[model samples]
Target chain A: MRCFRFWPALAVISLAACTTAFPQAPNYGNLGRTPSKEEIQAWNQAIGPQGKELPPGSGTAKQGQEIFANKCAACHGPAGEGSQLAPRLVGGRGALNIPTPSRTLANYWPFATTIWDYINRAMPPKQEGSLSASDIYALTAFILYRNDIIPEGQVIDATSLPKVKMPNRDGFIPQRLEDIHDLRARGCGAGHCP
Target chain B: MSSKRSLRRQFLKNGAALAGFAAGAISSPAGKLFAADAPSADLHAYGQRSHFENDVRIGSLAMWPIVPGARRDYGFRSPLQDSMGIITPAPLHFIISHGHEPPDIDPREHRLMIHGMVDRPLIFTLDEIKRLPAVSRLHFLECHGNSAAAGPTGEPRKALAATVQDTHGLTSCSVWTGVPLALLLGQVGVQKGANWIVAEGSETGKHSKSIPLEKALDDCLVVYGQNGEALRPEQGYPLRLLVPGWQGINNVKWLRRIYVVDQPYMAMMESTKYPSARLDGKSRWFESEMGPKSVITRPSGGQQLGARGFYEITGLAWSGGGAVRRVEVSADGGRTWKDAQLQQPIAPKAHTRFGLAWTWNGEEAVLESRCTDDQGHVQPTLAGLNKFWGIDADYYRLPPATADMGNFNAIQPWRVSRDGSVSNALL
Candidate 1:
């Protein structure tokens, strides 16, 4: 049961030796093969705010409406108008300032690329990662058009997706480490704060 | 000749009676049953209580369907009122998932890819990772959205219909065994300016979250073992990320890939789901670490006491910041407090058990517990927590629905009736 034990003296000696000696990379003999480029590409699918990793695909709002009805309408509701199952995607515009803020994609999402990234990676609940790149773009475009953020005929692709400005783009503030420290000082009893 | 015949007859009669008794015993119902069929005094190789033992986890009836017609995605709270000690049994641990059951993974086929923002991107198989230096530590993992039922009034009375599990059941402590993430990062050689690492799961939903590099390097573990055995399927069978002291979501289960990056990916979960509004009219994202909190597990809500004279009040207390230093129990609803005895070996970022002996006079009394961590952070009252969040007197009518989801560690009170029935205190 006692599988681990401490060796303080040996650990200290090793640490001193490491600092005194000229540092060199310790090779751990290769145990696994390097992954192929295709394998790497398949797993590295996260698209950030800049949309730099968006794959080559294009779709229009009209095409997205059909795909949405077939794939997403069951959970997200028809026309993305909200349902008891999933969140509302279209409305909630200018609702963040109200007492009961309805934080929908149209109102609260800071980056449109997030929409594409999330859909591409996880969506349609029952069948995730089943949609093609073009289908994801179309769904993104349809949601944008329904929210009144984009025109009806606009085509959404890698280039246009990142440019779509969301209403609550400025809603979030960077987390401050100092604020946590201050809270700890006030919340933690006097003289015991971290 | 007469004497010999009498003796032979007597012997024959005795033998006949013995044979009939033996036949009847073998034909009886109890003799026909096997060892497994009924309770026995003998021991088993792997211990399992008889079916007659009624100590079981009571599922909460308040669980609602997640996707309308789908009951598979439903959540079950832990029965806190029925829990006994610091560590929760794996079966009784609270479960919350995003609309899918935990995926079963084969260890042989599993691989953990450490790529992006690293000098030497590498993929590690389950066997290869296990061969590396290992560490075992006890830590408590709690969901960021835990204890939503306990509102600002300090009274979770509505949750009485449900067990304590419904109110504050989404937390558990266990001994985790894994290779330190820092060692893996060192092997991969993290590149400069990499501030974030996105940990992704292989679940059907591809549940993912962005973790700060500082945390990833500090005490994070790519864990594969829990409570001294291979993890349960529900707890991510083959592998999981153990972000000690952080919220449960950050500890991604079924861990498959880790992408080192210069900035947080701001995934849907992190951006839209985890962040909560603050009193300053701003939102705080990645409120990862849990605050100091404690709950009176015994005599908590639904349990009834029979002729209470001398009773022991005990519960579990934990803090994400550090080891719990002291726990205070109040028998008269915070009007008076007494220091409770903290159990030995209080591990950092682990649940510590505390107990106090009290003499009940069979009168109505309110019991509560407050814990303070080594870092000096004390558990806050419900009203104090509401005030910290800038909620006003009309909080019940217009609750801060969005802001108060995370970091909800309010003092829980239990009302003991003179008639020996214990219930949630409506403070």
Candidate 2:
């Protein structure tokens, strides 16, 4: 088989079949169908630390203060100090080493892109995915600013979000094959699954 | 034959069931009914457990930092003290909500989309997935945070004054039925260099996890059946991922998407919430796989042992590494130990029942059980586990600083008080 980088779109299954499919199980050929691009877009919303999947549009904390107060303050509290119902989003900046470090975004999250991706996909609780891209960017900037990670005027978008390094970027133990319990001797090693 | 008798008189309805018992400490199952008083013979088409069996899971949103409005930040535990055998009743299986509730979706309409870093991105209807070759195997699903006690490192899981049900009930096993995920990936022809796959669910929060492709290709499954029937709504209903022996979060319920990628996605659950913080402040990520552990269920906490002369000590033992090789029970704390008989079929990655006849002298004796898996890893003492996490075996009692703990497989000790009552002895 030839090696090539393939960008996938849904419903593209009718391109015949992959001869290499079904090596372990019986050749129960053609059981599933190629899905439409819309179906793919509906569920495959993953954005890694690189923020490569981040979309267009941008906003600053100046624009976010209003959005957060209107949409988030009820559960997260004013200025994201956290409330009885929800956890804190900002502040907890130099506390990762404490016995019980307050895992606010400032001290725990390893990537700024994760914050953007999380808000974009699941924010405002029950009314998730309802916010505009600009609204999400503003909210992210507002959180970063509150944690003193970025200035209130810093514009956040696909480009700037990836560059905003996280405070606890190196807080996590690096992934190692032998380190993954019960996975030793399995095909996984050195961050690759062979 | 009893119709001629007076309807007012009661009869031993379960005489045959009672006949199976030889009658040492056994009494008729506390149920008495006359033939005439029997209810209309609906036969309970769905089949209900005997009214005498009222075991229920513990769902408490009141478990610290109560998030009231959404009610989504909650989970339920199985009644382990009341559990029997290997299979956890489908209805009583433990649940971890993780900020999302089970969604309602028709099996016909629900589709599992498999895309990204593949030669053929495929979508399978529930029927289509079911149409493939299927295998049924028993496996246990345990949360990483199961069985943690309040210890010196921090206020982790629970207070010492909790029942075995409350302490170790977050785990349950089932005979899951479905096609292997390798079969599905085999059909998709996974692209070279793809090492991880992000499994997403249909919940409102889209409950998701990034799993190693090695695991998916090994024994992971797209199961739609549990025990002997279709999956329960709470157990992912029409479809779920079964990552055998791994921590429960990776077994995404109501599975919807499988996006193969080159590296970890580091989603919110994986990045910020699930990592276990070490004593040194650095945390471990993706440290799945529950280690070898066992706990005595009977004569456990909350239950009173009336006349504990010939009480049998029994509980469950399991390991993510392999089958339970052996289980040793200790009557006088860890000072002495004796091998317990392991009930069959002693399968890997599933609950193995172990028990032994004990003529309790009925003093204030402490009881504990430790298991060694087929991989030869012995279950660690609470102190040994603490030491493994960098240091300490005694209860130095520092206020628990963090919430997320990695794999809490420490041995649990139960104290049998002189009053014939059992309680948690971890303190």
Q: What is the C-alpha RMSD of each candidate to the true structure, in Å?
A: 13.6, 9.2
Worst 10 residues of 1 chain A by lDDT: A185-194
The candidate that achieves the highest lDDT relative to the unseen native structure? 2
In model 2, the clashing pairs are A10-A35, A11-A35, A22-B186, A100-B401, B154-B400, B155-B400
RMSD of 2: 9.2
Model 2 stretches with alpha carbons more than 4 Å out: A1-25, A175-194, B1-42, B61-74, B151-160, B391-396
Show model 1 residue runs off by greater than 4 Å.
A1-27, A175-194, B1-46, B54-74, B150-157, B160-162, B278-282, B397-404
Model 1, residue B218: displacement in angstroms?
0.3
lDDT (tens digit, per residue) of candidate 1 on B210-305:
888988998999999988888877787799999888778888889999999877777888878666665444555666778888988776665556
| Model 2: per-residue Cα lDDT over B210-262, one tens digit each | 89889899899999999989999889989999998888999999998999987
Give me the TM-scores of chain B across the candidates. Answer: 0.83, 0.87
